[model samples]
Target: MRTPHVVVVMGVAGTGKTTIGPLLAGRLGVPYAEGDDFHPQANIDKMAAGIPLGDEDRRPWLDAIGAWAHGRAGLGGVVSSSALKRAYRDRLRAAAPGVVFVHLTGDRELIEDRMAQRQGHFMPTALLDSQFATLQPLEADERGVAVDVSGSPEQIAARAAAALDGLDATAPDAIAPDTTAQAGPSPL
Candidate 1:
């Protein structure tokens, strides 16, 4: 919404984080960062092998994304990550102040169907269950908008853009938070 508000599009696998992230960023005229780009080769290998990432495995990855967000402060960009836990979101927020989230949500059947239709992604449908288990929905206090994935990508992106711009009538709460004052990243 704001010029420097880092928007993290988060959700379990198959909720269209990758698909919508770029669209949202483009609509906002900001850079788009793929969360997968931050993962180490080892992590990718593990995921490709159908192994779920533990918190320890995610620490460095989260930090890298956080640091990127920190560097982009005041320039605003969109990034996509599962961000499946509250701690992970908190860490990201601490690293990049004024960060907001766009949570993609839907029924398991819809999501699993979507994942099954994908090809060449390191993350397989087999791990979707784990991803959902790990996902902690955005709390009411969190600065975010929960967009259901039932709509077309363009529809979702437009709604997200409008939400960020305080133009979304359906969900008026997506307005940007007051972020003139911000704190620096926390220690890793």
Candidate 2:
């Protein structure tokens, strides 16, 4: 059997984190969480009003997501977040040790086009520049894979799974010993 891995599907808005996260979790046979749901209503309202969130506004939200990830440390699960900065990723890592990140990346023009077409999302397309500016790609030492958002979600998830092939749980496969559920909160 193998220990379950916590996967964070991270990227800027419109990178399809929401769409791809659940599919990735399903592929991994784990639960899925929407990181956006972690944000307080105030944050949502701010974004809905076309206001970019300052770092202070994001701290509690980041902490909440980190705590959620921490709760799933030993079990496999997927969560989506716009983890756009190194400090943000560090905060998540601090809370959930060994959490692997799946960074969804793509060309600016392509992402903006997708954002322009999206509806009912709190994040405004106008803030796309700030997202790009804040983004810091995963470091070489990070346990993660950088996947291009150019492909379909299925393809992207497949690639991410493949990228994590050598990362099988140190303990045992989830199916072994009938321990499908490891240690973590129920899927959100």
Candidate 3:
């Protein structure tokens, strides 16, 4: 049997992290965690009011998610987070050293459209530019795959799963250096 590694479904808001995380977890037979649930009311309020959260505001939230990821170590699980900045991902790695990331990448226009169309999400479409500005694509040294978000949720999840399957799960750093290039083009 293959060893199970926890997967962090990461990307900018509206890239379908919430949608894809659960499906990927089902495929992997692991529990799914909504990263936004870790946020304090203040953080939510800030975003809802069109304010982007600063690093100081995000530290506690990231720590909470990291704690959850740390607890799920070896048992396998899926969790969603923007994890846009390298520093945030580094913080997560500090807590759960073996966690692998699945970055859902998409075109700015598509992501903005999705955000605009979605209802009741605390993250406003107005904040999307800031999100794109903050995102740092997964680096070569990172243990992760970058899956494009140009398909249905099921298709994207499948792609993420297939990319993850290519990783050597037992290795400490299961890096996929060129997976981003392999994800292909945006349809719209």
Best-performing candidate as measured by lDDT? 3
Model 3 residue 46 CA deviation (Å) reads 0.2
lDDT of 2 at 127: 88
lDDT of 2 by residue, 1-188 (tens): 14567889999899999998998888788889999999999999998888888888888888898888889877778899888887777777767766788999999999999999998888889989888888899987666788898988799878777766655543235422112223332221
The per-model lDDT (C-alpha) reads 0.84, 0.80, 0.86
lDDT of 3 by residue, 21-105 (tens): 9999999999999999999999999999999999989888888988898899879899999999988887787777777899999
- The predicted structure with the larger lDDT, 1 or 2, is 1
Model 3 ranges with Cα > 4 A deviation:
169-188
Better of 2 and 3 by TM-score: 3
Per-residue alpha-carbon lDDT of model 1 for 1-188, expressed as tens digits?
Answer: 54556899999999999999999999988899999999999999999999999988998999899888878877889999999898788888877756888999999999999999999899999999899888899998777788889889999898888776762343443334334324543333
The TM-score ranking, best first, is: 3, 1, 2
How much RMSD separates candidate 1 from the native structure? 3.7
Residue 143 lDDT in candidate 1:
78
Backbone clash pairs in model 2 (N, Cα, C under 3 Å; residues 3+ apart or in different chains), count: 4
